[model samples]
Target chain A: MKKEKGKELVAGLFSLLPIILAISIFLLLLTKAFPLLSLKSLPTILFSSAWQPQKGQFGLWPFILGTIWVTITAFILAAPLSILTAIYISDYASGRLKKWLVPVIDLLAGLPSVIYGMWGILLIVPLVGKYLAPLFGTYSSGYCILTAGIVLAVMILPTIVNVSVEVLSAVPADLKEAALALGATRLEVVRFIVLKKSRPGVAAACVLGLSRAFGETLAVMMVVGNVPLTPTSLFSPAYPLPALLANNYGEMLSIPGYEAALNLAAVVLLFMVIIFSLAARLYLNKLEQRID
Target chain B: MGSRQKSTDRRLRRRHRAEAGFKLILLASIILVAIILSIILVTILWKSLPALKLSMILQTPGTGYYLGKKGGILNAIVGSLEVSLGATLIALVIALPTVIYLNTYLKRKSFLAEVIRLSLDVLWGIPSIVYGVFGFLLMLMLHLRASLLAGMITIALVELPILSRALDETIRLVPAELKEASYALGGNRWQTSTRVVLRQALPGLITSILIALGRGLGDGASVLFTAGYTDRITTSLFQPVATLPLAIFFQLNSPFPEVQERAFASAAILTLLILIISLLTRYFGRKLSRHKVR
Candidate 1:
């Protein structure tokens, strides 16, 4: 046992080296970059409304608002459709059909985000411009929050459906049988027993979906019109934090402290994602506990 | 009595139709997503039709659109292949050991494992643009200019979270009985891990690697600052390299139609590559799981 323990210790130390190195490098970079800008300046940089790089004024409020708007729009559009579809697939579809449909969802989820962005650029934006924008107003840019939100919804649908379906499918067979034996209809059983049991998982799925929507950069950047202003309407041009960083980093090289500010923005975004995913993990843990 | 029974049957038939309607809507959702994907594919092909001639694939990028003389995306394709493969290899080397450590020696340290898992999840959630900024700063600090080496290292960092989680999950999925049997034979922990658990998890690990490769190959923004675009292919890892996705991004904003068409063609190629890898990984993963069951 002692020899086995020694071998295990050696193997463990070896395995941890790479992860430790990667994390330390990231943290070291963060530390080096942080002192360039004062902590007192961070709030204005983050919360102030204006962002003119030429004037050396940078406020992240508009970008934050854009991110929140697009993500919320995506969730609102995707959540109901995803939940309804998950319910139908889990409770109503035949076993054979479910088997085939499940893989399609998986495939959609696995497709890289860049491809989705390309598709949005080549097809969806033009179609929206040609058809949908005419109804809104002549001044409306075709690639606006609506276009991005719709594409984001499509991108996040598979994730939501996959998780919700798994949760709904795991609703105890005995509960369903008991409901039916009590003379409750199939729809009633689904409405009450299955959904109630799977609520946490479904909620977790929605949070995960929101997380993806918020973090999505490539597709939204391609179609978001990327104006650095707070959007007053769905058709107004805007910029999210990710897009702002991506679009300006190359040209901002001559601007003093722009790089450090961008890094701070990134750090903030990373913190938000950490909080979101931690909430999701906690929800999933609670669901698992309930299941046990 | 006969009339009452007939009414009951009709009511049952109507209820069944409503259930069928719900199913139809669900199926329609799937079809809708598929149609959108197909439309994107068709649009790319349509846009790139002018550049679909054989020479476009074989020739190099040069000045002037010489109709049939316009060179192919040879350099961009080769560069993508090199950088993506290089990054995947690096990520695998890093991820494999981390996964093994988490699954075995650190298994008892649930708190630490949870923290690691949470960090990885957050890492995956962080936007690619953030990675670009981080990479640029790190490279500047290290005195490494914008080069393939910087880009590859950045991509490897971005991919580590997913790859590690995949490896960890697959390692955990290895049957406890297998490890116990190895231990009974007087095999050490390293022996059990490398010989038994790793062998069992190889297929899943390969799937994870392929997924990471697909992500790296399709990445654009993260490498934009780290690896500036270069048309001429170079052998040195410390030089600029043009990749397919970056080519697409650059071409989209270009004034030239030919360049834009080439971008579409490149995007088409990337989309198909990712789709193919995704399908193959899913197939192999299923096969491996089935093998385990037997």
Candidate 2:
């Protein structure tokens, strides 16, 4: 029995060996490429305004600004729609409506980002340039921050709706019923009882949606115009970090510090995603604790 | 009293109208999302119609935009199949044992299980582009060029978290009584997991694999840097090959109509394949849920 127990422990440790090795190798490479941990390059890399790699200029402000703008724009457009749809499905919709709506939402989630990019290219660019851009301003380029933001909003809608529906559905039935019994209207119950109860979950959903938008590459790449400069307006051309990395990395294979710069951008993107997910995870954990 | 009663009635009616307005807005939002999705699909199909030909699928990468119609995408199709399948196989191999160990041997270790879950969550949250860069750097270090093996490994890393989480959830749903029965009959831990728990979770496991497969097939950016696009099919795992998405990515930006049309047709085919896989997995997921209920 003792020998068998020893073998099991060894096997268990062996299972973890691959992940540990991968993580270590990643960290080692990152540290070697950017030895600026001792020189305080992170703040300059993140907060500086310029990002020209030709003359050793490496400011991430434009990339950061573009990423934030696109994600916030997407969130503003998608959140209310997704939340409303979730409310409809959970409260007002019948079984038939739910059946159709749920599958459609899932199918949306399953569609590849490339398809979204293709749609943006063949459909959105032309329509926006010819019609919507004129209405916005003569300053509008058909493929700008706003166009990419709108497409990203559509891409992230299903994620928000799915999470929001799960959260709203899990709201305690008794709380909602009690509100209804106290002469509260259905809207009041939804606003006060259900929404308030599921606040953490809704927040988690929003953060998750934001993370997805932030990390999105293909869809945004196709529509964002790929100009590596700060934008003056929603209609102005802009380049996001992911798009820059995707477009330039392959060509920069032999260029000194180019691969490093791409890796740094990736590290930044990873950090942003991790922060959002970590916040969401913590919020969910707190919610679970409260329920417990 | 009559006036007061009338005022209350009026207020209630106004509130009802507001509620109805809210519902209308909610319904409109759902309909709008659906319309957008349909428009995207319709637009893609409509635009790609001019390029829909058997030759496009059977031709190789041609020299000129118009004269390049000689070779079909048979090679790219085969390449995608092989790489994606290879990645799926590797992911399943890695995830299955980890999930089995967690669910069976380490069931009592709740802290460890939570840590694993948290790590997996973080892994999933990490963007595919980052995985691409990571894989690229690793390939450089290992001297593994942009080959199918490198691409498969990168995809395996991306798909690992999803497969493991799905497997873990499915394994957890297996009734404790079944494991207890197996143990009572003098079966060992491995035997119990393989014979009893896994047998019960087979449908769910299959669903997980299908989801992973779909995800692998859909991914393009992760493989872009790792699997440098090739025009011809090669049997060796270390050779470079093109995938459908990669082909679309490269071709869509070209000014030629033929190239653009081919991109559209390829996009449609990829979308159809993914949709079919997604539906099948969902069906299996529902089946597994029903079995659990009983």
Candidate 3:
């Protein structure tokens, strides 16, 4: 009885570790960020694009907008491709084909973002600068929002594809068979029955992709020119929140109020990511219910 | 009636063609993704050729290496291994116990378990750069210097969720009857958990640890400020240390061709390290799964 009781006590203490860590991280970010809130109004901090920190202007609009632009552009590129890939794998691919494809996708997902950054610099940037930008009539050095978005798309594609594949596979086989029995073609069954049934899971996949793309640092930071600007074109230079925080925090430590501003940026980034992930979870819950 | 039948036949033909075309397009996308991945690997390997000599791995980084000078990345490699290994160890201490608590001690639908799962999901989504900033704040508050120790602590926080979640899923997969059998044999909860559960979950636990290790090794943002960079390798936890990701980042930014070559070389080295770790994991997983009942 004593041993059992001791085991329970130990287990209880260890289980508190995650809760404590989560709460402490939240508190740390909040405490650091609250001071900046007192110093500046929320609207000013969020809306103005003028961010000359040396002259005391600490607006975050440019970074936030940059983040949104890059994330959206990546999503636009990745969603269709990943969804189609998932559909092919789940509904059409032969067993042998799938055996080869699944491992490749998994490896792509596991590849580090730093490696992606390297590839962007060596391949995508130059390709864009030399070939693609001319077709669009834009003069790009290639270290721009477009390059970052493309790399980010590739980095996050596997997440969407992996989730979508699992979701589509979980769809009841009877539903597709029923549609076929009603004189529906293969395409119709897939489009009208399977795709419709897996909509919630697909939405969750897209949101999860968005969350990951929004927070990616090393790859986007390396590809996107770290210039603080409101992006005017896909080829225009801009800085996202993660890049800005990473580039400036080392210097910001010595300056008054600067570190607080960086912390505030992190706070914003954290909240946005958390919100997206929660929404994804909510969709996943709905998907589970439908499956049941 | 003849005209209507003809129109329906035309529509069927067009729909069939469309299906074929869409399948081709989907196939093209998969091929495109594969092509891009291969091209990345090829380009890095090709560009790294100039600096891929044997001595690069053997010797420490030379002075002025960042200024387009020729040198090696040995220091950064050692530093990254030490920090990631240390962080993985720390994360294991917390993750293993928590996973056991969740699987063996609590009901599956318990409120605390749900909350932990939710919070872990949130933590998994939080960016590594945010972890870096948080670590910076921690160091400042404690009046401690940025060192290898700080980086390990920060990375442990970053990796804990991933490791715990992976192990939790594995534990959840353990059959109820097997666990019940242990209970029937008069095994206490701890004994059942450690002896039966851990034995069954060994392969998965190793995989999770390797995954966390791979993630920890590849990350640059979280360690950027916490582990201050150095040209020389040090084993002391209090001392600042260099890392491969930072080495690649700083080197690639320099305007010198030679320095840029070193950057590509370092990238290749990092990629090779990750590949080796993954291959080892695969081998280990296959070998160990023979003993795993499920």
Candidate 4:
């Protein structure tokens, strides 16, 4: 009887952990942000690009736009390549090659973000400064949206490829065989059967990748030039929401309402990511159903 | 009929060409990813060569080393281990139980479980920077200063979702029959989970913790405000700590070439640590599964 009571107690305690955590996070976010939310309209806070705390102005549009620009640019650059890589791995590669290559992709996923940032500064900055920027008739100190986008592209590529590979591989073998039996070529089978069937999963992969790129801080912070301006060109310095929060949070307490504004920004980011993740999960569930 | 035959031949040729072109593009993209990885590794190694001395590993970072001087990242290295280990332990304690409960106690298809999992996923997706902001606010509210303890707590929050999710999946995958067998033998939920389920999921649990550890070690944003950097090494949880990621971030931003070299060296150290953890995860993962009856 004592042992049974102990079991019930343990189970109840453990089950409360998740509930407590969820409540705590929600409460903390709201409490920190309450002052800001009370003072400013959400639209004013989100739409205004001027973030001068001393002047009591906290428009977050520049950072929001910056985040969108960088994420979209990264998505455009990475999606095609990742999808292609996934296609190669799932539909074309021999068994031995697939075994060798998949681990490398996993390694890419495991690499630290700071290292990616370091590489961005050492190689990507200079390369863009010297070659890529000039072609577009812009000058950069190597810290710009383009460089950040490219680095983000590299960072998110593995995620997109990994998920896409799984999705493509799940395209039933019979589908491909049936396509080939109907006189379709190997590429045709992959394009029509594998690629077509995995669209929802691929969409989920893209949304997940976007969420990652949006939330990424250290690496993007390193290369984004940390400027709070609306970017006029790809090579112009821009600051995203994560970068702003990181760059300013340390000194925020010294200024009145600064901390509150920063907290509101965090709430904004939290909500944005929550939405994207839910969408991704929704699509993934759809993909699961389709697979079944 | 002759004209139709010629058109069909042309279409066939075009389709074959398209296939070849598509294959080539796919191959190039794959190679591009491999090339980028090699480039990053080579560049860090090459740039860090000057500062990658044994003393650099042993000595604490010193002031004015940017003028071609000698100093090591020992403080940051030790600090990273201290904070990450603390965070991992806290996260593990919370996560292991939550996941166990999620898998064993909760009804698998219950709305509560679904909501919990979804909440965790959303939490996992929230960026490290947001966590830093949240931690900063918490520290302010509680009248606490940025310290090792604060850093550990913040990172624990960051890592909790990840570890719990991974652990949840691992525990969920513990063949249902094993749990059923335990129940048949008069074992309660706690006993079955603590024994049969945990033993089967040991490898995965280990891997999940390692993943969290690796991420905590690499992350700089969450600790940027919560863990004030310090040059002096101290074991006290309330004191500030320097971390490898922050070290690299601060050092690389210095204009001096020597300081930048130190940054690269710090990155190399961080990279090496992550690689070792990856290898260990693989090695232990294999070893742990070797005796499995499955």
Candidate 5:
């Protein structure tokens, strides 16, 4: 009984650590962000595009929109490709191919973001600058919204593919077998039955990917041009929220509200990411229960 | 009947055509992802081959290191090991207990367990940069300088969610019969958990730890502000440390070609280290399945 009591006390204390950490992090960011909030109304800070930290102007509209643009474009590029790859791996690929393919895809995720940034610098920037842009009768330095999106797409591909593959695998085998037995082709069975059943799971996978893309810093920073202006088009240079903090945090104390402004950015970034992730987690949980 | 039969054949041809088209697209997507992965690996290897001298791995940076004069990245390499390995150890101690308590002490499908899992998922989802900022603010609050200990603690937070989630799934797979057998012998929950649960979950436990270590080693943003960079290898917990990710980020942006080459060298070295860790986990996972009761 004594041993049990001690174990209970220790484990209980340890488990509460995460809870405490989460609460404290939120509170700390909030406290840091309070000065910005008190100085500017929420709408003025959120809707204004002015961001001269020296001038005490702290509008985050540009960065906020930049994050949205990059994340959305990345999903547009990644989602279809990832879903198709997942479908093929789950339904058609041979065992040996599946083994090889799964590991290779996962290796991309394990690669450091800096490496991806380097590749972006070496390949995508040049491709966009030299070829894709000029082909459209436009010129770009190639570090723009589209370039970041392409790189970010590659970064998030594994998350989507791995999760989608798992979700597809969870579809009851008998449903597919029954569809096959009824003279439906394999592809037809997948489209009509498996896809229909696992739609929510796939959506959850994309949501999970969105959460990752929203907060990616170094890779996007390296490629996204960091011009701090509202991106006017796909090829326009942009600055994202995480990149904002990364580039300015070192010298934030030079200005009056600079520290609070950056802290508010962190607050906003964390809030969006947490909402998306929590929703996906809860939805997946409910989906699992329903399917089971 | 002849017309109906003809239409049926037409529909069959269309279905087959659609299937073939999708098949082609799927194959193309898979090939594209594979090509991307290979391109990254090949490019890093090709660029780093010339700059990656034997001494680069063996010796610390000498005078004019950034000028491409002499010396290896011994300090950054060693510093990465200290921070990530230390973080992994710290994360493991905390995560193992939380996971055990969740699986053993809590009822299946309990609300508290669900809430904890949700919180972990959110924590994992939060970007590494936020953690960096948080770590920086935390250091400021405590009036501590950027140091190895601060970096380890920060990275430990980053690794905690990954470790706990990985462990939660693994521990849940332990056969219930083993627990019951222990209880039948009058083994307390404490004894049953430590002896049986820990043993059965050992392979997964180790794999998760290594995975967390890999993440910490590869991360640059969270440690960027917290770890702070230094040239010489210092053993003190309070001293600033260098890491491979920041090394790559800083060097690649330099105006000198030689320095950029060293960045690639660092990339190549870091890549090889992570690959080895993953390959080891795969091997151990296969070899250690013997420990499982089933």
Candidate 6:
């Protein structure tokens, strides 16, 4: 009996590890970043575009704006297509196509971000610089906000599609069949019953996709020409928070206040990711539990 | 009556046409996605074809390797494998017990389990860069340099949530009757978890681990700061290690066209590794029958 109690205690302690980790991560970043908050007002750091770290001006608005532009663009591009693909796979696709799609999407989702980054550099960058930008009456050097958005949209497609498909699949078939028997067209049945029922679930899927885009590092870093300025146009280069951290975290030791500034950026990114992901996770969890 | 019937027919025709049109659009989206996936694969293959040599895998980068001169990426390949494998081992050791504890010692849907699950989900969603920064700060406090060991521990943190959440899903599928039967046979919680639940969820456990391993192997940002890149392969725990993603990253940034071409080749190798892991996952996932005796 004593042995059993010990085993339980051991396992229980391990279970608390996740909570402990979460708190430590939050506290460590917040504390390291607290000095910067004290030194610089929150509004100035968040709103100013001036980012000369050496001159004691450490505005992060450009990076924050860049993250927003890229993520929103990716979200706009991915959300509808993900829903359409999910609908097709769960409803319209034939057996053969369905069989192929599950694995193909799995492959897309599994391919590393580095591969996507390479693809961004190799294909999207050139396409944007040479063709798309010019069509829009502008010239880009190929590394720009739009290119990053395109790459990110492709990268996050599988993540959204997989979840959306599951959400769509879980819609009770009986409801659809009943709607069909009432003389509803197939699309009407889907749009009215399936889509209606899965709205919140699909919204959660898109939110999770947004969180994913906001946090993506290497792929966005590669294509998003890391110039520290607010992105005025899609063809302009921009820097994002994750890229800022990845690019400057190691070399910032020589500059005073730079480490704290970077830590604050990480904290900002942490908040963004946690807020979006937690909302989606809780909503999805509730939906699943209700069903169960 | 004739006019009314004709109007109703027109409405039906429009609705049917609308249905057909909408379905076609949806079909087109799926087709576009497939084409893009194919294009990505083909592009990687085509770009790397010239640089894909057997020696590329067998040898390390030599002097002036970045100058488009001589050598391969064996250092990165080994380093990536070592870090990911190491992280996987550590995560599994910790995660399996946490999962067992959740499913057995705690009541289903207990408040503690709910909080644990929620926290892990949030951790899983936290960007890898935050983990990188966290690990870097920890290393600073300990006066440790960027190295393979630091990378492993950092990645292990990233993998922990992934492993636990995924394994949680798999273990949840184990029927309650099995546990009840184990207890009926005089098995305690430990015996049921080890002797029964472990046996039941092995395939799924492996599958979840593979998924986490794939994430760890392919991840670049979390280890970017914790494990600074190196051209030379070292078995020492304290020495900086190279990885496939960073190798591709650095090589692609090279001015030399030859070096740039090698970047594509590196991307292809990384993609191939992940592809194999995904395939293994599919195989094991299929083997993970939802109910053993239903």
Ranking by DockQ: 6, 5, 4, 3, 2, 1
Off by over 4 Å in 3: A180-183, A285-292, B1-8, B68-70, B284-294
Q: Report the C-alpha displacement of residue A28, candidate 2, in angstroms.
A: 4.2
TM-score of each: 0.90, 0.93, 0.95, 0.95, 0.98, 0.98
Model 6, B80-164: lDDT tens digits are: 9999999999888888889999999988779998888888988988998999999999889889999999999899999999899
Enumerate residue pairs that collide in model 1. Answer: B56-B72
Q: What is the lDDT of residue A206 in candidate 6?
A: 87
Question: Which number leads on DockQ?
Answer: 6
Instruction: After the best TM-score superposition of candidate 5, give how far the Cα of residue A219 lies from its true spot, in angstroms.
Output: 0.8
Question: Which pairs clash inside model 3?
Answer: none
TM-score of chain A by itself in each prediction: 0.90, 0.89, 0.95, 0.94, 0.98, 0.98
After aligning candidate 6 to the native by TM-score, how far in Å is the CA of A53 from where it should be? 0.8
Per-residue lDDT for A13-68 in model 4, tens only? 76567667666776888787788778888899889878788888988899888888
- Report how far residue A230 has shifted in candidate 3, in Å: 1.2
Give per-residue CA lDDT, model 1, range B1-294, as digits (tens). 999999999988886776567557767866676676566667777877776666655766776542323677777778887888888888888778667778776763487666666556656666677778778877888999888898898888778777876787688788889989998999877788899999888898788888788878887778878888786774899998878887777777777777777777777777667778888888878877876843
**Could you arrange the candidates by TM-score from highest to lowest?**
6, 5, 3, 4, 2, 1
Residue B12 miss distance in model 5 (angstroms): 1.4
Candidate 6 docking DockQ:
0.85
lDDT of 6 by residue, A110-140 (tens): 8888889889988999999999999999989
Q: How much is the lDDT of residue B215 in candidate 5?
A: 93
Clashes of 3: 0
Q: Compose the digit string of candidate 2's lDDT tens values, residues A1-292.
A: 6755665675476457445644654585476458433444778877888877776667778898888888888899989888898888897789988878887888788888888988988777777777887886665557888788889999999888888887888888898888898888888888888988897798798888888899888889999888878878877778887887788876674545655666677777778778997688667656755654
Clashes of 4: 1
The 10 consecutive residues of candidate 4 chain B with the worst lDDT sum are B284-293
Specify the CAPRI tier of model 6.
high
The TM-score measured for candidate 3 stands at: 0.95
Ranking of all candidate structures by their lDDT, best first: 6, 5, 3, 4, 2, 1
